[model samples]
Target: MIEARQLTKRYGDKVAVDGVDFTVRPGAVTGFLGPNGAGKSTTMRMIIGLDAPTAGTVTVNGRRYAQHSAPLREVGALLEARSIHPGRSAFDHLMALAYTHGISRARVSEVIEMTGLQSVARKRAGAFSLGMGQRLGIAAAVLGDPQTVMLDEPVNGLDPEGVLWIRNLLTGLAAEGRTVFVSSHLMSEMALVADHLIIVGRGRVLADTTVRDLVLQAGGDTVVVATDDPAELRRVLVGPGVEITGHPGSEQLTVTGLPAREIGRKAAEHGLVLFELTAKTVSLEEAFMELTKESVEYHAASTTGRAA
Candidate 1:
């Protein structure tokens, strides 16, 4: 397990990471997410002892990373794929890492095959494609057979097949009772892969909970009813328990706290004819966008921005 207690970091006048507390448990895929410049990389660097925190603390398996006797065996991370030596062959790179830990050549081969890099094992890392580089990075992270793995943007340059491979790989690692903490900006991918999520924005945690809980908390199962008489529908839906909102200029009512069937039955009992009555559960991407919009640092052209 990885735990952070009020973890904070600052560089000069700018605070890269604020006091944040979260945990990544074993046997689950926990997603770490944030917008650009939201301090995800900084936090990962601090966890791995690459960067020092100005305040608070973080520990891996109950000890600081530096305090661990066999840190590589306890935690493995792939922070950046390009951090490897470009001129070295993939096999040579893993061999060097194995040498430092007194690991066997057989183990290096095992990881090479496991990451699907056998064909390119002898190729220089500089000549490998981005997807191959990412695979090589994963091989390095798993080379120690660590109990905890942290991968930042593991699927950045992957194709569809490569993406599926990584999703299965991370899930398999977690299934083996290993802690898998992955960070990605793709909400759809995270939604499909992560069992739990730690959403950070502006250097602080906005949420730390299961995907289901986050979606529920962001509101779900909204019933949209299109009717010519929206005012009557509003009057019927208006009460202490139900929420009714006018949907733009259309003669539609967005109802919450009521199931679609219940709304349909209510409308039918009231002798109301509806053009459309649809139950809409908010998608993870939509929920994530709603949660992180205010936290986003970079806003591109409004005219070109993709609609949610």
Candidate 2:
């Protein structure tokens, strides 16, 4: 498990992360999401002890990251895809890291195979492709089989296949009861993989909820109805809290503040035949945009930024 209680970070006069509180439980993938400059990276850095917090606290399992006797064995992190030694071979790099904790050559080989880096295991870290480097980073992260794994933009430079691979891998790790927290800009993939989300904006926590609940919150009681008698349907359904649009000029009626079943029943009572009736469902991306629209840090003014 991971906990951040009123966690905060500041630089001089700028506050990067404000007081934020959230929890990441085991056996599920938790997405860490925010727009650029929303302080997501700063929060993640504080979790791993890369940046000291100005106030509050963050803990992995039961202790701060640096307080652990064997931090890597408890929390595995992939903050950067290319943080390895450039001059060393992929195999050599893993060997050096393993040597520090008495992890064996077989263990390194296991991770190499697990990450599908067998072909490039002997290649210099500097020459590896972006996708390969990401794989290597993931290999190192899971080398200890840690109970908690946190990754920042793990699929940034991956191809379709690589993206699919990482998706399955992350979910599989979480299935083993490991706490998986990931930050990514790919909303579609986040919808498929993440069980919960922690959204931030302007250095403060905006929402921490499940994917299902977030979408539900964004959705409404709007139902789309297509009927032969549009005018009659509108007249019958017209009432308090019941809005009927797309009528008179068209064959459809967008009825808000009513369920599909209620709409169908109401139309039938008035002898109106519904060609189609569907309760509109809000997609995860749509819900995310609607929820975080106010929290977006960067605004695109126009194609007119400067005198180009």
For model 1, name the residue pairs that clash.
none
Q: Report the C-alpha lDDT of model 2 over 196-283, residue by residue, as the tens digit.
A: 9999988998899988788867865678899877887888888987878893578888887788998888877778888999899887
lDDT of 1 at 306: 69
Candidate 1 lDDT over 1-308, as tens digits, reads 99999999999999889999999999999999888988999999999999999999999999999998778789999999988898999999999999888889999999999989999999999999999999999999999999999999999889999999999999999999999999998888998999999988999999888888777667776788998888877777777778888866779888877888988888888888899988878777788888889999998877666677
Q: lDDT of each model, Cα atoms only?
A: 0.91, 0.90
* Backbone Cα, N, C clashes tallied per candidate: 0, 0
Q: What is residue 300's positional error in candidate 2, in angstroms?
A: 2.2
| Candidate 1: regions farther than 4 A off | 226-252, 259-274, 303-308
Q: What is the lDDT of residue 195 in candidate 2?
A: 94
| RMSD, one per candidate, in order | 3.7, 3.5
Alpha-carbon lDDT of model 1: 0.91
